[model samples]
Target chain A: MPKIVAFACEHSAYEAATAALERKTGTAVSGENPRFPIVEVEILKVPCTGRVEVIDILKALEGGAGIVVLLGCFEEACHYLTGNVRAKKRVGYVRRIIQDIGLEENRVQFFSLAPDMDARFSGIIEELSKQVVNMGPGPVTRIRDQTTKEQAQAAQAR
Target chain B: MIVAEQKPVAEILRMIEGYRKILVVGCGTCVTVCMAGGEKEAGILASLIRMAWAREGRLGPLIDVSETTVERQCEWEFLQEISEKVAASDAVLSMGCGAGVQAMARMFEGKVILPALNTKFIGMPERQGLWTELCAGCGDCVLDRTGGICPIARCSKSLLNGPCGGSQNGKCEVSKDIDCAWQLIFDRMKSLGRLEALGAMLPPKDWSKNRDGGPRKVVREDMLL
Candidate 1:
């Protein structure tokens, strides 16, 4: 299963992902949140979605994440007033960049949901993991245990 | 301020191919205000190029990328900060305007400095997320007669006399969104009780003072001392 990294805003998506995990595991883990037990989802908590930038998303791809998901508050209900909106624009920009690079533009995804929407959160993770697995291996450099350059060199050697 | 736009990502990637060490330099003045070539922009472009090539499965020990932004690229004093980096890199993907690119060229002879921005025009922010051209740098000054508006910059015809026959409802023939510069001039002059000035037949503009004069220079002997 391909691991998908979601930049979950603390105000919303993180809470919802926590809720989903709590419902599944019956307890919350301290510190770093591990990958979803059922699906390969790495939930990286952020202060707000608006803080997510074009470079962040692109770097995630370069760092070996199969697909990057940006989860923020609803467009009009952004905790920072326009953080979610800014995240949306960055997501759009990354999509265009990916499209221009002749890759699957959908690798970068954006979603708006509240903290209580655990069911939706679980569904998105499962769906994304399944989607990436079906898409098979992408041209993205899988950093693995080696440096990104070394990984790319291995890929080149292939 | 001078407004500029970044060239396409693909085109930029194409420009830096085969170069071992690439330096992405951004200008902190006008291009920064316009969100084109600035420190933040330079970092973003560097990361972008790194990822794009990595995705292509061709990134190895061959190509390395670095980025820096100066306070102003057109000034030699500010450019001295990045002199060593410029000398070491195979190519510089400059995020500055055309002048900045040329300045780099003149300052560091034989170094390859590639332009990453298409220097658009002298413009000001129309609103929060919009910009509009405001000047053309014409050697002649006529704003005193045209009620503080430049017909050459705003009008499609660059007419000095008045609005062309195509102007209607204070809008230019080129587009409805564009206000006719002559209409604006007339209205401004009329409000200032200077409408009589427009009736006077002005002679033809001196074309030699413009770009037709070839590469021009402003030698201020007083300032040289």
Candidate 2:
């Protein structure tokens, strides 16, 4: 199972995803299962992408997330004027830092969208999920496994 | 206020790599107003380091992470207030100015103290998010003679005379971004009907009184209550 963490803006990305899911369920007749693969993602909701701090993004990666995505408002459309703009710069900063630490910068990303763009939201999620799957697990997960193994060995010795 | 910019995250992480428990300190004065090494920045940096350590599975070396913002890190009382916090941690990461870092090191004595900001200069905000250097604290202020502007601090050449002849369109020839300090001085003197003061050749500035004399100090015998 692939693990991806996405910080979804309450005003745009989160709303769009909710709306898309509702429409999918609404169109399905009784007892007909939705064909879309339910991707395993931990969605963190933020009032605005601007509120998503640089540390929050890094924490997601540290918490065994193979991929981290920031979904916010489209350019020139943020309700908070420069919310999306600020988020973009912070994401860029985090991306450069992670790259410097020997991690793939592509593991972290940002996408802008509108509240009504449900199809686009789902498309982005699917594309990111596929990309993460191809990239395999992140360094954080490997480190966790190594630490756990060492701890277990030490316990056995004790 | 003194302006500062955070050292890159990678460099900061590398600095505190070996420490198990760290206390992140912040200055609430100059750093706060400049949007640099303040309480908010301290929390952000602490969180980033913890996350990075956890990611690398170096959890053993980053057990306890604490943060505190003092009223002024450069002051002894403020450092004294967080003495217990500093003692509890293996190291201290100070989000204060250069002076604050040394103050902490002086007070703490033996702890590993790291600086999180590169203290830029004594400056004021030119706009909402822009800072411009305005003072050199030459120990001899000449603002009265130069229309409240310090040519020692602003002029590219620090010329005691008028414009260096390189000034063009009121901008410094060195960079279009910087205003010609001498031009500003001339304009101000002209408006104040004090251009005649410009002709009074000022004597050479005393070098021993400035930074060239080494670490400056102030002893207030009257304030010793």
TM-score (C-alpha) between model 1 and the true structure? 0.88
**Which digits, one per residue and each the tens of the lDDT, describe model 2 over residues A1-158?**
45678788989988877776778731111212233244366677789999988867866776778788899998898989999999999889878877766677888899997888777877777787778777766666766677889989999999
Off by over 4 Å in 2: A25-39, A134-142, A152-158, B61-65, B191-193
Q: Which stretches of candidate 1 lie over 4 Å from their true place?
A: A25-40, A135-140, A143-158
TM-score of 2: 0.86
DockQ-based class of model 1: acceptable
Task: Compose the digit string of candidate 1's lDDT tens values, residues B1-225.
Answer: 999999998999899887878999999999999989998889888877876766665556667788999999999999999999998899999999999999999998999989999999899988866889878878887888888999889989888878899999999999999999999999999999999988888788876788987888899898997
lDDT of 1 by residue, A20-52 (tens): 777873213232223344435567899999898
* Candidate 1 global CA lDDT score: 0.82
Q: How well does each candidate reproduce the native contacts, as fnat?
A: 0.44, 0.38
Question: When superposed on Cα atoms, how far off is each prediction in RMSD?
Answer: 3.5, 3.8
